[model samples]
Target: MATPLENGFSAPALRLHALDSEDLALLSAHVQDALVRVGDIAYLPAKRRFALVGSRFDWTAEMEGRLERCRAGLHFESVQRVRCARVSRDEPDAILELLAVTFEAGPEPPGGVIRLTFAGGAAICLDVECVEAQLCDIGPRWKTAARPTHELSSSESGAP
Candidate 1:
């Protein structure tokens, strides 16, 4: 129910809403990079919500800032409990595309868990606090940052 706000740049930034697990699943499908801090993650058992506040990378033009990040907060409602609530091997930041998040269905009353599958077979499980949830994007604004790039291999350029 949130509307877009003008930021004096490209079109206004709009608030995103995901009322269920399915919607939340799509957010991570092609998400390659995210600025995550260990302190940014939280689980409120009493409120049945798991939240993460961070910046996500987007592939956009330079005028808009390619490395420009989107500062947003994702709230996963109806969380029962979290299995592995710690970061991956003391890594403060992580690549989301290298990770997969799955939500499994459970008994009628208890609900299920949000499974976070990372590279090297590392996984974190979050037990749902209820049968349903609301995944919402409270903010979406572009931030200034350097774009990420990689050097090309000699084989591809036919120089070797």
Candidate 2:
């Protein structure tokens, strides 16, 4: 089998869209450990959009003895409203580590709540008309020594 690089495949900047639950899951995986400053988040009521910029861990690139992170932008369209919990607006400089993105359907079809969960019990919920979101790598990547890790819960470890 030809190596990925040998086959002329190169790591390119990510530009992805999420139109449904499955797509959102993939997008979430790419941004699993992104670090976002509270000040970077914005909700444009006039445009019906919610956006944020973050330093996203580059999971696609080869480690090559070092980790990497790059600036990324994520946005959701047709957003009706935004609600946050455990994320204080008073602390603009505070950084939050993104954990996952999930969707919960509303009573009406094609409408739902998109939740962005972060470390320290912080979360942002977007009331959206549909699953319409985009994630793009917006800048050059740099090397990093730190890799994010998640501790498994007792139930997840199959232990009593």
Candidate 3:
């Protein structure tokens, strides 16, 4: 339960440690509107860890102005393509909004999978060496080309 900025400037800009399933669940909720490029994912089994970086797009009033410019079909130099899309499981054809990315760790032998759950139930699971992974923030914020449209229904998410 720490903010991405909790550790101060010396931290990895954004990094989480010992994040179990419950931790990931909480993180998914915090990273509500991050952007992810579907094709930019990687999992290296030999390292016993997987790493995925996302642009911080948790939206604020200042970003609203940039979002409007993007909507007007004007490309904002401040907005990088990597910050405008999300990861999708239902459809891998393009970048999609990042709703949540969960890590389910397996027993010894160091194995698990990183599941990137996009808006809706769409998700992409990456088999990794283990649950040792760090999602860091490595890019500037940008206005999304489009906002995702989906609902996280209780019946669908099964969280009461």
Candidate 1: regions farther than 4 A off: 1-11, 30-32, 59-65, 85-98, 107-110, 118-122, 129-160
> Candidate 3: worst 10 consecutive residues by lDDT?
71-80
Per-model TM values vs. the true structure: 0.59, 0.85, 0.49
Cand. 1 Cα-lDDT = 0.53
Per-residue alpha-carbon lDDT of candidate 3 for residues 28-68, written as tens digits (9 for 90 to 100)? 65455655454544444444333444454543322434331
Each model's lDDT: 0.53, 0.84, 0.43
Candidate with more favorable, higher lDDT: 1 or 2: 2
lDDT of 1 by residue, 12-114 (tens): 3324454456755666542334555656777788887777765655544344543455655656676766766334536655533225456666776446666
* Runs off by more than 4 Å, candidate 2: 1-10, 62-66, 151-160
Index of the highest-lDDT prediction: 2
Cα misplacement distance, residue 133 of candidate 3 (Å) = 2.7
Give the TM-score (vs. native) of candidate 3. Answer: 0.49
Off by over 4 Å in 3: 1-12, 59-93, 103-114, 127-130, 142-149, 153-160
Which pairs of residues collide in candidate 2?
Answer: none
Model 3, global lDDT = 0.43
How far out, in Å, is residue 128 in model 3? 5.4
